[model samples]
Target: MSAADTTTPTKVPLPRQAPPPTAPITPPGRRTSGGATVPWALLAPCLLILALVLGYPLVRLVTLSFQEFGQSQLWGFKPAESVGFDNFAEVLGDGEFWAVVVRTVVFAAACVLFTMVVGMLVALLLQRVSGWVKTLINIALVASWGMPIIVATTVFKWLFDSDYGIFNALLSKLPGVDMIGHNWFASGPEGLAVITLLVVWGAVPFVVITLSAGLTQVPKELEEAARLDGAGAWGVFRYVTLPILKPIVVMLTTLSVIWDMGVFPQVFVMRNGHPEAEFQLLTTYSYDKAFVVNDYAQGSAIALLTVVLLLGVIGVYMRQMLKIGEVE
Candidate 1:
């Protein structure tokens, strides 16, 4: 080739540029779905089950609260006759219902406060203990919780029984005691006290476990630093430990309130709605209205009211939880 031809670049056909590789088509079965869509599809069954089991009943309950039973329809369906707000008016106006509600709120509040304080104290003690003692304490508390509620109720009832109660027997041994066999569940306030004691006994272990877990999350360094700064044990706990534990404490308190408010078996077995329903909390009241008196309408109304109260309590709790860091 001439120098000029050699210097010139060879006219080799440029390699054809290949089209950008396309994504492999997912087979109808093998294709992965969108992030949001797949979750919703998988959740469909659970949502359906929740609606059927929880949603429908709650809706039915609210509906029943607004209706009264009437003659069965020709199709054999007994549609409730709407009574507008009569049920609400009746429930609100009933002195007994309001009394029970007030008692429930007070009892639940007492239970939550006492249980949280006692449980935190117990947890602090447990943290100070060592090895086998810690294990033993845990086992004992867990065992108490594992006992069946009915069994616990029966045992407590016997402990507080009018004739054969150990509590009265112990009282008899005290100096100058006149009444040895006081009936714990004879009056409204007294019965509520007994119920509150039983509920606190059953619930404290859970608080202990939860609070102890929260305590573990508190940094040892922070505690040591607080101590070096001349902060006393109480001061450290008040400022450092408690602030960290606020969320867990709030959660436990909320749960305890919810649990104690709905308590039934302890009061039921202790008194059986005795002394003219003196010991009837909302749960027992609803049960008695539904089954004993066959007043399903009243029962449904009670249930719906109880639900509203609980929801309100939960809303307050959530608000408190949200406001935890605001003060600090």
Candidate 2:
């Protein structure tokens, strides 16, 4: 065989190497399916638990709220007599109920605002201090937070009690002879004030801890640069620290509102929402309806209403937080 005849034929392109056996082109949907199934599988148990615990109860509560309960209906198993919104109408028509709602809103607002302010102040003070002072403050705040709610309520009740209260004792020594042992719980506004003070005192510690952690995250370099640029301490805080702290502040405020709206222990212990239900907030009202009045249906409705109000507030806050240029 001559060289030319024996040589393998000159190499051909071979149809462009068949495009290098390109990887099996997965459909977009199929790719999504592959990555998504694992997460869905893992989340199934959580979803199931949530449905069983939260979703079912919520549905049941709504259903029960529409039903009528009587003394004979001890188990509440009898088919719910269609009340046709009578329960809601009756609740809305009641002047006392509306007053309680308004009072709750005002109380919650006051508590949240005062708690945030006091928390921020305490946090800033701690930031500037060192050594034993900071440690002591932190310990006191944590101790208050760690105390059982029932214990705290009992202590506050005793402290504020009119008969043998330390408060009344001190006031009596202040030369107020006319009403030395005046019944604090008998007065509506006074009872409400006591509740507000207790709520504020209990919640401030949480706000302080959250804000202090947020304050520490403020960049030292930014603060220093601001100072170098002739910014005062207040200016540095306003321009640098506050903008970063906005989210935390908003979050803390929202949480405070939620906590105060559902306030129960203080009012329950202080006077059991007494003096014509003077210190009754939404949670106390619900408790009275459910347990005291033996009207779980009405109580569930009130509870649901509270939940809705909270959700509405949260939604508004989120909208404000998410809006561009709103934080600054």
Candidate 3:
């Protein structure tokens, strides 16, 4: 005891410091009362920019839809007179308008169907192909996708030219299938079909890329398990793959509907910027009303209606996405 006490000094305990100030812990999937405001604060600048850029135009469009805005008013010779829903009534009552609506819906549906099927097939092919082959196909798709709309339309026009077109040339080679001098744009149905093809061609690239990325995320174990459970190729795809791919498919279909319904440049340029009455979709109809007839109010009304339809589609898409997220 004497030796130990001499060698070692008496120990003294240091006082513990209080814990540093910290934020209150939030449970997973829950936020603090103030957390909701944080995101809004960060988004404020972007919201402001969007309001500045789009708000005024949208307001003007709505106003125009409810007024009688014409060339005279546009030139400042007269003020726009309020017409209430007259423009909407006129558009809604027009038999041609209804016809155009039906045609537009069918065209968009066909385009969406073809685009999804072809895009999915190509995505599956990409998964099975050699690396270099897939790379080449991707390059081709990107090249087509990156092509200017006007340029692509013009190219398609040339390809279907009645006087000298490779399409007719190629078809003529088929035994007894004389397609020489066949005018693809002579009829509305034929012309719209060609336009559909063009649209599908341009749209497939994005669909392929998106689906390919999604396919990578699918669990291989589930696929193997399905196969082991006596699922054939089609059975596995129908039972396993399709369920997982539903969200992407729905999103793509909605977007395609919006785009295909709003198809203007392809139809316009294909017909030399003067699409025939038979060729008119909602976008072209609006343009024709506003510029060709100098009826800006009616044009705005049609455009507003188109926007409503698109909003409906978007709402459905958002609802489906939320449901998918909830399921996940």
Candidate 4:
């Protein structure tokens, strides 16, 4: 062994194992190389249904708005004649139409403001509750949200009915109040107030539930730190909580505005296309002119205008919210 080349035994290096075959890299949500295909295939049916139900009607309505779609055309076995922008011109020329548009804008603003404020309070309160209390409140809110719009409108109409209504009965009980024979439905302003009440009441439940869910995702440690720094309840919420909740609040507010602006059931039940033209909203007005007055083209034009206005308003809101978020 000591001799230079005599009997030296060499240790053999173990055969280098190829790095364990790298597991085929897959993108999240994909089970295979063709993962995206199946999901899209599954979604195709829903998309087709939506196109048939929503897209077709929207296109038809838009086309109808540009035609002379009077009752004769609507009923007769003939297509409507293209009248260009005549229906829009007539609708836009009416000063009364503009008034309703302005009134709808104002009404929507008020409803959104009311809904957001109450919803914010309810969401904040929910944060402080626990266990069964929270569960019970959630159940109540869900029930209210699940209620049908038409049924809710009927309940509200009955409550505010001039004769044998619970609301008037309560008003009559007030000190020195002679509201027993009061006709709340006869007055436009008062009637509008009832509609607003209905809108706000029905909307707040949704706002509260959505906002509460958002609040749960907020980091509690941040809130506790703010409190530890001698920040009062209002200070903590205004400076810490609200900043985190801004996106949710903005989203809910935008939805509320859209819903209230296009509200129909409550207005229909309360006003029913009466002489109180002052209380009419876009939806009710459009329905009246289209169905009640038998002018489909005019109604479609108004509806198209409503869609345009809603889109514009929502776009502005989203832009503003995004800018504010970026600045903060």
Candidate 5:
């Protein structure tokens, strides 16, 4: 056809192909139901294990706390009788229980304070030391952390023994000191002080390792910047390093409190399984009530109360963690 006449067959545009399917858009701050369930699904096995391991004992403890379950019922000679709030009332009313509670609190606070302070100091030292020295320190920490509680307690007990303890011998060698036959456990406060040292000794390793790891995550550049701004060692740590390490500190403190408060083997074994009234912590107090005095229900009630108190601490920890998460 002639060029002009070739007005040609007009080309027709093919319709645009539809875009390929895509995932549905979820709104901000929300997830798809299936996506949301993934975390729970991943956690189900752990939750199930915890429920199986802890559920029955917790339920039994609560039930026993509300009943009159003494040696008679314990051996099946008589049925456990429901006593409503009697067990709780008796425990709450006893002056000794309050004393034990106060002692436990003070002991835990002391342990936590010493643990954090020593741990932080060691962690800072680790940062400044040579590689080999840091490795050596870490190895020592791990070794101590791995030591069994019973073994450690025995070692500490011998160290502070009334007659032949090396600790006493060393003290006696000092000028004008006569500690050759000193009995560390003769008084309640003195004995508790020794146990506190042991607890702090054992607990320091974990805190050190954890804090050291946390310190590694701290941005060195931020610390350097702080230094450039005329910050001293303490200032850099307080303003820069500490805020970064707050969560770890909180977690370690909470765990230390829980562990120190629940200490039993130390006091029990130190006193040959019969911690005197002066040496009694909540754990030993409950043990004395349940086994020594054969007051099972009252012991359960005391233990339950201790659990509630610990739960409060855990609640505070969770709240702090959530706040930190939000801030981040």
Candidate 6:
């Protein structure tokens, strides 16, 4: 009893400590509620404006998709009644529709990729240039970025026109480009190539400006440190510069996707809405159905499909942004 009691009597009380401070948690892509709450008064104006400007048109378009608004409805006094999912069935059931959808996705992707690459290169070039050359570049960039879409398309047409195009003129002088006219719009591929070049040319300026700005935000010391560590120029950029520029690059690339989706004027004017052109992108198809073919309800359905496709693309981008925001 004496030995057992002696061992049991040595119970020292443990010291209590305050619980470790809980870390502040924030949902991804959302601001933490740690600061003063935003007043509804400050947000209401924006919300109302958005509702009228964007919300109403979107709802109207969606509603239009379900109605059979044909030629008779468009010009006639007869009101079009809701036709349920008939418009959707017609658009989705068609083989040509799916073909156009696939083509649209590929075309948009190509344009975005090329535009990003060219823009990045131009941006890098701008960083290395200075003095009057840099000033001229900046001026040229602003002009290109600000140019009218129609005007740009027109200029591109002149540059690529088979008979009188400067491109053909240059190519004919080369070793074996005997195809005199080399019709840019002779086939779908040729037409798309011209449009792609036009889009890239116009889009590069914005990309250059944006990437150049982003490059400025990168810490110079980090770059210097990397270089001091014997990293080559490409290595420094790959490891250090690119990591900092990633967010900007992703954003600009997504914007390019959106801009490339509805490439109407370029394709329309180039093809002159030729039915024989073996390719059909969603934008042109929708316009053809709605206006050219005079099938408004079916056209609206296709238009809605385009919107849905865009939303899918945007959702992917938002997820990436949210992940980045959460990590910080």
Q: Model 1: per-residue lDDT, tens digit, 6-119? A: 685769898999999999887786647566688899999999999999998999888877888432422348666789889889888999999888877888889988999999
For model 1, the superposed segments whose C-alpha errors exceed 4 Å read 1-33, 37-46, 70-79, 273-275, 325-328
lDDT of each: 0.84, 0.82, 0.93, 0.86, 0.93, 0.85
| lDDT (Cα, tens digit) per residue for candidate 5, span 1-328 | 7789868588999999999999888889886666878999999999999998999899999999999998889889999999999999999999999999999999899888998999999999999999999999999999999999999999998999997799999988899999988999999999999999999999999999899999999998999999999999999999999999999998998999889889999889888998888999999999889888999899999999999999999999999999999999
Steric clash count of candidate 1: 0
lDDT tens digits by residue: candidate 2, 178-263: 44577877777887887788888888888999899999899999999999999998999899988899888888888888888988
The clash tally of candidate 3 reads: 0
lDDT of 4 by residue, 2-93 (tens): 58769668999999878867787787886775866888899999999999999988998899899998867877867779999999999999
lDDT head-to-head 1 vs 4, winner: 4
Task: Tally clashing residue pairs in candidate 2.
Answer: 0
Higher-ranked by lDDT: 3 or 4: 3
Off by over 4 Å in 6: 1-49, 273-279
What's the distance in Å from true for residue 1, model 5? 30
TM-score: which is higher, 2 or 3?
3
* TM-score (all chains, Cα) for each model: 0.83, 0.81, 0.89, 0.86, 0.89, 0.84
Better of 1 and 2 by lDDT: 1
Q: Write the per-residue lDDT of candidate 3 for residues 1-328, one digit (tens) a residue.
A: 5786678676899999999999878888885777779999999999999998999888989999999999999999999899889999999999988998999999999999999999999998999999999999999999999999999999999999999999999999999999999998889999999999999999999999999998998899999999999999999889999899999888888898888888889999999989998899989999999999999999999999999999999999999999999999
lDDT of 5: 0.93
User: Which of 3 and 4 is ahead in TM-score?
Assistant: 3
